[model samples]
Target: MRLGKTYRKGGFMNEKVKSGSRNVAIVGPYLSGKTTLLESLLFVTGAISRKGSVKDSNTVGDSAAESRDRHMSVEVSAASTEYNGIRFTFIDCPGSVEFAQETYNALMGVDAAIVVCEPIRERVLTLAPLFKFLDDWEIPHLVFVNKMDRANIHVLETLHALKAVSSRPLVAHQYPIMQGEQLTGFIDMVSEQAYQYHPGAPADPIPFPESLKEEEHIARAEMLEALANFDDHLLEELLEDIEPPQEEILKDLKMELGADLVVPVFFGVAEQDYGVRPLLEALLREAPEPEATAQRRLKNIKGDTALAQVLKTFYTPQGGKLSLVRVWRGKLTDGIVLNGIRTGGIYRLMGQQQQFVNEVDAGEIVALSRLEGIKTGDTISTEQQAAIKLPKAAQLEPVYALAITPEKRNDEVKLSAAITKLLEEDCSLAWEQHGDTHEVILWGQGEIHLQVTLDRLRRKYNLPMTTHLPQVPYKETIRKTVASVHGRYKHQSGGHGQFGDVFLDIKPLPRGTGFNFNETIVGGVVPKQYIPGVEMGVREFLTHGPLGFPMVDLAVTLTNGSYHNVDSSEQAFKQAARLAMQTGIPQAEPTLLEPILRVEVTTPSEFTSKVLQLLSGRRGQILGYEGRNDWQGWDNVSAYLPQAEMQNFIVELRSLTLGVGSFHWEYDHLQEVPEKLAERVIHSNGNGGNGNSK
Candidate 1:
């Protein structure tokens, strides 16, 4: 594949027009200055007249109202610019762990990623997951250590911390020239050229500093050694004490980066556009071309037919759906049919702003309007190539949930419609009309993720919602057996009188056995026809037990009963059965059973003890802990925790682990709630003390 042409003044003259595009994603932890870097890149490349700051909420990225309100990127924003002759589209991704699904989805389509991050060592751990993703997918990525002006540690220390998290080798592409605490300039490691920064202008060449010769030599030597690991010629020159040429070093960097063999690190203060120009120049020179990425991603599928995959989705207030898709193999023209859905319009995206484009070439990311059935991460192709599907990013399981209800009863009719659109926009979001609680629960990555979705619901759909912590699906079960309980129902009316009597034997079953019913009646005393009604009554009463919860892990038997032939009816027998349960259940010692989940919490090894303490504080039973598979310096702690204590567990876990910890959980079993807690729950539900049965 042809490499991207170098940048020249007044554009390329003799070289062929660079029609190929490079899709790169900017990602990092929260407050990493990704959006600011985007603004700087756009401004430096003349894509925008003036740079916009994220604090002012005027940056091209993070233009959504939800993002502006929070002053953080909550979704993926796409902006395209031309650096040199090559078209470069930057996908600015959210840094928050809650919005990682957005980052992962956008990352799948890009040729490379710029992992923007702070220079603080404490927060360096936050990039673990992101680095793992890039390496796992073999997507070439480079690190841009932003906010250098506020760096608390030496640059080498920051690099050391970052290296602990990434599996690949990290080579410093540039070394910072700091004066005390403030960043003034940087030295290009490959060229060994010193440059000073100027506000709103390109960095100018400067004489190499004599005072920092030793440090620069060490940093540059390390970079060359890392590149030499992949090139034998460079290795020979290094061992012989012969200096390698700059062009040879650049070639090695480009080749190693394109193959995802090494990660080049750069230093920058994106807020002031310091070190931004050099970062861009490095991207234009070394970042892999889209064709190289496509070759790796689509090696098996062979066709010239238009093929694309959606990286993000948007639902406009005008009731139109927009699918931001990456054109992988062929050109995508306006109004082309893909997967049986004809594209309504083709447009290029600059954040929320859309520009009409008749057609998009291969390797370009663009928005196609009114793709009704297409969703984020779905591969779209012509009918002949419909079978050619690309693997999408793994769907993130929701770690937080909220029980939601419409603020206005009239809006209830629109809730499902609105939430459907909301889920379409954010595939990480999920909703369910819960079977046990009968509540409409919205599940997402974290509190902020769901909040942004809620804001969109109110703003775009005009359906405001009232939300609260989701109720745990607690249940009640008996601990003892009650035998030979008798109940009678007799009512006199103008017509035939109602008369029915029943005898019941109720007992507790093994845990998780659920509800069971059997009849031991003899001589048809209760009559077979009325047995169905009796069972129905028992099940209906179980829907709400004496403790005001669904009853489980119990069985009831119809021992004996009598009924008058003329007065006996199904309804009468049902009432008789209900009466028997009311009299028998409380005597059987009904206990509140709360749902327990088997949770596996993954965190850095250093925080395992704190994680254990956190679990124990929440009444969790520790199962065990061991080093997590395939994750370096990480441990997975397994425990059983009550669902009630899980409402804010993620919030606490993230807070403790510097926002890098997470877990996976599933229903394990039902266990009795503590005596004190059970009492409080019963009283809070208005059942009082030992429940209404008493």
Candidate 2:
């Protein structure tokens, strides 16, 4: 169906922007002031009249109720503005490692990214994972060392720390001027021009201070040296002590940056809007255009057909489904149906507010409403049969889990549907119907990540949820063999009496050899039909043994039995077998067994020893550790850990490694729980009825 039509009357259809547009994502560690940077960018660009603070929850970014309540961004927030005759769409991404998936997905659609970070050297390790992602994808990025005014250490030391986490060489773009522990001004490294800061106005140029001339010379030479590595001509000039032209240095910076060969470092204090103008000018001059990004990612977006990629998905009470899509090629207009799903309305998003638009050109980021079947990372084209494949963000593995149930029993079905929508909105969320414990386990990156999802459930779906630590799937087995246990069931209360008798032999099997059943009868002592009933009874009793867990690695054989011709029945025989287990299992030396999981923990090499110590403290058996195959400067430690100890492993691991550590685990084998802990667990299970006794 043809869907081209005029949108709402007098909308942004008449407000045409320049063809030069770029999409940039602001990302860093949590509490690095990404939202504040967005506010400064918007205010300086005339997109917003007044700047809002994160404390007051009035910022355009972090507009979601969950984010505002927590005062942290939960997802990517998009805003558009024009600066220096160039259009830009800046996506503010959540810096919390728990929400890094949001930033990762948005990064795929942006031309470049501003890696906003604080000047605290101790917290610099938090940037490792994000930096690795950008480098792995070959995305051009710059580091904005924020909170420069509050820096307690030298700027060079901060740069040194940042360089440790990044794979690309870093070039200093500006040098901060400090006067008695306060930021006074900055020197542009390339032009050697000095500027003094003025609150709420452009920084005015001034003469280069003689006190910093020597230091500035050293920094500029180092910057030039880093640039020279990529250009032989520049190297020759540097080697011969011939000063390179300012224009040549700028060109090298632009070329190397756009090519993802080097990362240029800029200093700023976003709260005071310092260095924003210079940052904006650098972006305008150096950051790659959208076409360059598209060419690097998508090879065949040259066709006339409309092509776009879904970068994120959102659900609102008023608007059903909003798919945030980046138009890669061709035009996206109202009522367009791409790849079988029809788009209802098109909008230009400013934080949470939507401005209706009739048409938007390529290289623009916009929201398409009611794309029901569309999902994040999907490539859509207007051609009905066109199948185009585009790059997708890496899927994040969930490290933390919680068992959740609806607070209202009647809302069970509603909870399932709500969870579906929630997962649609945040792809990092996952859920499982645990087969052994029968718990509905919800998984995510961390505690806060799952907490935000629960809050969203309550706020958006009106479904209140209660969560608990997931129960471990534990099994039990007999330590010794017992034979010739007799069980008889007789009842004579009605016209037909029930009478059955059976003799069974129980024996221990090898570990990991699951349950087995067998029978041997002679001279028709036990009828074939009733014999099956006896086996079923034994199986049912084994499901919840004397220790209150499923029995494993054991075999039961019906050695001898008797049944009356008239009174014998399958139900009677089954009950007789169960009675035999109830009487014999306690005497068979039954013991509790807990599940052990094979865990693979990955962290920076510096934290490998800490991780090993952590595992040892938790009674985990260290199998080995080695450098991760695909990740540089990271180690993967393998261990066997009790499932019970893993409940808080992710939380503690993040605490130890600044939230960059993670692990993957699965059930490996069953081991006997320690006597002391087992006793406590048994008592707790008995009181809480968590023993899984049917």
Top-lDDT candidate index? 1
lDDT string for model 2 (1-694, tens) is 0112122111101123224798999999999999999999999889999999999999999999989999999999999999767888999999998998999999989989999999998889899888888989999999999998788778888888888888898888988887876777889897687888888887877788888888778777888988999999999998898988876887799889998999999888899988887888778778888877777877754567888999999997798899999998889888998998888999989999999999998898999999987789989999888867788998898888999999999999897888989888899999999987888999998899999999989889888888988888888998988899999999998788998899989998988999999988888888998988998999999888877778999999998989898899999999999999988888888888988999999999999999999999888999999999867789999999988888889989988998899999988999998888878778878788554211
lDDT for model 2: 0.87
Which residue runs of candidate 2 sit more than 4 Å off their true CA positions?
Answer: 1-19, 300-304, 630-632, 689-694
- RMSD to truth, every model: 3.1, 6.1
Worst 10 residues of 2 by lDDT: 5-14
Query: What's the TM for model 1?
Result: 0.96
TM-score of 2: 0.95
Clashing pairs in 2: none
Rate residue 246 of model 2 by lDDT.
72
* RMSD in Å for model 2: 6.1
Q: What value does the lDDT take at residue 632 in candidate 2?
A: 75
